[model samples]
Target: RQDPTEEIQNKREEDLNKKKKKSAPKSSYSSVLIDKDQEPTQSVI
Candidate 1:
């Protein structure tokens, strides 16, 4: 039988992963910033 606490933790982690995938996560920030730097129009408001 699975321990309830471990199962709940795993489920919570899975939900977080799903949310990260659905939204743009900051882990991609540096690479995204580098790409954005190539085009400055967006940076300048």
Candidate 2:
């Protein structure tokens, strides 16, 4: 019973949010990347 158009709209919104996050300032973005890098190393231990 789900509407296909509504699902498409939700996907579009998610894409817009991802784009906005990518456009964020470099300092915060770098921190996010660093956290991601550390997570894998921590898991290996």
Q: Which prediction has the highest TM-score against the true structure? A: 1
Question: Residue by residue across 17-43, what tens digits does model 2's lDDT show?
Answer: 788778875554566658776642323
Residue range 1-45, candidate 1, lDDT tens digits: 999999999999999978876786654454565776675333422
Worst 10 residues of 2 by lDDT: 36-45
Per-prediction count of colliding residue pairs? 0, 0
- In order of appearance, the predictions have TM-scores of 0.52, 0.50
Q: Which residue ranges in model 2 land beyond 4 Å of their true spot?
A: 25-45
Please list the C-alpha lDDT of all candidates, in the order they appear: 0.70, 0.70
Clashing pairs in 1: none
